[model samples]
Target: MNKRMTGVMAAGAAVITLCASSALAAAGRESSADMRGVSVLVGGGVEGYTRGLGADIQPGAAYGATVILRPTKVVGLELGYAGASNNFDRSNVAVSEATRGPDVMRNGGQAVATLGLTASPVQPYLLAGLGISRYNVRATAAGFQDDTVGNVPLGGGLRVHLGHFTADARINYNVLVDQQLATDLPSTSATSSTGGIYTGTVNLGSTF
Candidate 1:
């Protein structure tokens, strides 16, 4: 395991610990105008990016859930899980030239805090959070084992609420961990990755 992964896991544990304590205290209170009491979010979206020798990178669909604990009417803490896989087509490569480039899969968790502007028909909101992503890349080239990478995402999104359900769109930029990409491959060297780590997602969920 890489040290970056260890740090990510540690941060996730800390978020869980803090949210657990908050959830317990919030549970004793009744749902009111100022608080949601409890909510569960379920949604899916696309992810796109590439590294090394892939020109056409396929977008991957991801599904995840977020459990929310509302301490105040407008403030909430959420923990979420998301995962996806991507495959890219490679051309004009010396070593893996005969074969397609690689297929990659990533899984990770996020911790966020949401501030609801208004909990009404049009509930626009803002979210800020820290995310940890673990990615495994496998190339078709022989002697190239799967590469595991980790990254942190920082960004926000907008949400609109309707009754028990809500729709939202968010954009986040991923900062890949340095050590993960510093390693080299046989045919190619991991210099820098192309495409923006920026990801856009649309989601829907219900409050319980």
Candidate 2:
């Protein structure tokens, strides 16, 4: 893990701990029905890289799992892990055969706070969080260096609750910081050091 990733993970841990403590304290004053329990979700979707990363990586399939802890009907915290497989765009004829590389695997972890607009069966929510992303590519003759970066994810989604089951459609726009991919291409400037990722997913889960 890079320094930025390590810092994000530490900050996330602190925020989660504080939120959990606050939730426990509030639970004592709230009715059982008003406190939503924990939920686990599994989902898959597509992700597109933008800016620097988009120049070399192709959009691809993404999958993830999430754990949500709702202390109150309208407030919750989410821990999520997601991964995507993206192919290198080799259309650039200037690229030498030796510089060409295999598929790239992108993985990320996030800790987010969510706020629901309403407590009805159908709820719309906003989320913002801190996250870390890692981009791994198999070493090539050109000696590409893998990178890890910290990110901020911001987005919103709608959730439908049916008895103990829930379904959600969510999208997140991730801003990546200090992302340096050391491809060391011959003619072109090395890959961009900053980029963005657009992700959307549909998740189904059960509340306990």
TM for every model, in the order presented, reads: 0.61, 0.72
Candidate 1: 10-residue stretch with minimal lDDT: 182-191
Tens digits of lDDT, candidate 2, 48-165: 7776566666677778999999987889899999888766666631334443434677888999999999775556799999998888865342334588877888998766555566
Regions more than 4 Å wrong, model 2: 1-35, 93-102, 139-144, 182-193
The whole-model lDDT of each prediction reads 0.54, 0.68
Give the number of colliding residue pairs in candidate 2.
0
Candidate 1 lDDT over residue span 37-92, tens digit each: 66776766656554542244455555677788877556879898877766654342
TM-score of 2: 0.72
Model 1: lDDT equals 0.54
lDDT of predicted model 2: 0.68
Candidates' RMSD to native: 11.7, 11.3
